[model samples]
Target: MNISRRQMLILLPAAAVAWKSVLAGTPESSPNYKMSEHWWSMLIDISKCIGCGNCVRACQTENDVPDGYFRTWVERYHVSDENMTNPEVISPDGGKEGFPEAKEDGGKYFYVPKLCNQCADSPCTQVCPVGATFVTPDGAVLVDQTYCLGCAYCVQACPYGCRYIHPQKKVVDKCTLCYHRITKGLTTACCEACPTGARQLADLKNPNDPIHAFLKTHSVQVLKPQMATGAKVFYNDLDGSVR
Candidate 1:
């Protein structure tokens, strides 16, 4: 059938409106879209951490981390000498809540929280034979348990020894950056649970966010720079001697 010029004109406007409506309804059109660039990271201030283990408990409750496995943990480092030749790195009982009071000792003590670095060139993604491990558009590293073959390639590929195979589920699991929470317009459990506000969750893509400003104002460094993973997590006022 042949359409008249007038009929074609009428259909064109309707089609344009429909297309515009669809685009406008998408998340990309929302103000939050600009903040979703797949490069989410975190900055931890060593001085602000109180070793309270609030973040640890919050992660377990929020993500249901297995009893034996932890999505995140804190490490205690002690450096006695200015030469920095000898240092002690110890993690006592995974920093679970109700930890015993610090023993009487003569050394400097500080806690460093550790989690998935969520690298841009993530080794987990490269080692996943089934493509189960992938980086999200917003820079969050995730594992698709559905597609996982129970292989521990990712577990081994990680340099920081962060990833682990869940004992009960028999699947690899690690920190997800609270994907559900962030998508729902909420901060990460660890960030929310932090009493000192040392841990923060912000969109790196949003220049208006404090994180963006912090990155610009202060010098930050990722863990294991030689690995060249382009890690998303940054540490402010980090001691270069500590790995």
Candidate 2:
């Protein structure tokens, strides 16, 4: 059908406006997301941590993590110059409550928050016989609880003591870096609760992310570099005795 130029101009603008309205009212479909384009990481400022346990509690509350187990925790490290290799580490009750007063000792004390490294070459995933535990395209290591064999192989394979078999779920569980929240463009619960800004969720693939600037200016290190799991969590001013 042919239309007059005057009629075509009026209809074209109205149709374009309606199309934009429909798009604005609808959320983007997840199937269209290309998760492979993102690589995730976390940055820990050891100097800023105060062992407040806010992060620990937030993680448990957000994930419903089991008691006497931790997807994340904090440890107080006491290192004496006389024995740098044997730093005393303590995290009573997984540090869900803050620590008590200091004891009489001549040493330096600091807090170190621990969580999943979300390793690129994670041992936990390699040891899963059923492939129940796997990494997402966005770089989170997750377990399919329905498929997990309830074996502790993933726990054993983890060098950083980050994995555990859930007592009730009967499946391997660990930190997913709050994949549910991050995918929706929100930060992790732990990072959100960290009062001192000690924890930061980072997208290494994003050039504009502040983590890129932090890395360039700071001397950062990951736990047990020798294992070479391609651990992604980075710590700033990490003590030499840290394992």
Candidate 3:
């Protein structure tokens, strides 16, 4: 009665689902929060970002993320006049303490913050063998660590290299968009910490939300658009050189 790895992977989801059903009474952090009434997303204004690293520090403190790994990070891109398509990107210590001064000053330098896109058609959610990764009703992607197999299938499926295996918990981990705070009617730690208002929490479902106005007037793009993951995070003033 032995099963190969491939067969076992196919079988694990059933067991995980059954186990989850038994413990289905997991209480919501904010019981009054209505998932149907909102859609969560983020807007990153590349022009406003100063590479201050406040967002990175705030995310780590609020989420208690591991020292070396990052749930949210900032990358500095140096695009030269000769190489408009190829940019030199760097993120030292996940840009937690800011970046060093650029040695070559001829090119345009800017900071791009990275995090979980919380895609509507996330590959991670579809590939989770244990049914641990899933999208919420309000357009957030989350992982049930208790049921996670730490198999890294979702990690491999992610096009943006956002997901990671936790060092101690042995579960796949990534940004939850500060789900706890958001459901409680608060903004994400990173967005709140950004001094220049570089990061903004957006709710597409809310007509009055400023994001609607911003989206109407500005040109925006998502990372790796070719993957067609239905990414929720939008970048404003994104340069063509960004990868």
Give the number of the best model, judged by lDDT: 3
Candidate 2 lDDT tens digits, 1-243? 999999999999999999999987734545554687789999999999999999999999999998899999999999977887899899998888999887767789999999999999999999999989987888888989999998889999999999898999888889999987787677899999999999999999988999999999999999999999999999999988888
Residue 175 displacement (Å), model 1: 0.4
Clashes of 1: 4
At residue 9, candidate 2 shows an lDDT of 94
Q: TM-scores for all candidates?
A: 0.81, 0.86, 0.87
Model 3 alpha-carbon drift over 4 Å, by segment: 1-29
Q: Which is the winner by lDDT between candidate 1 and candidate 3?
A: 3
Which residue pairs come into collision in candidate 2?
A: none
Please count the clashing residue pairs in each candidate, in the order shown.
Answer: 4, 0, 0
Residue 217 error for model 3, in Å?
Answer: 0.4
Query: What local distance difference test score does each model get?
Result: 0.81, 0.91, 0.93
- The C-alpha stretches of model 2 lying farther than 4 A from their native spots are 1-33, 103-105
The residue-by-residue lDDT of candidate 3 on 1-243, one tens digit each, is 999999999989989999888766653477788999999999999999999999999999999899988999999999988887889899999899999987766879999999999999999999998789999999999999999999999999999889899999999999999999899788999998999999999999999999999999999999999999999999999988888
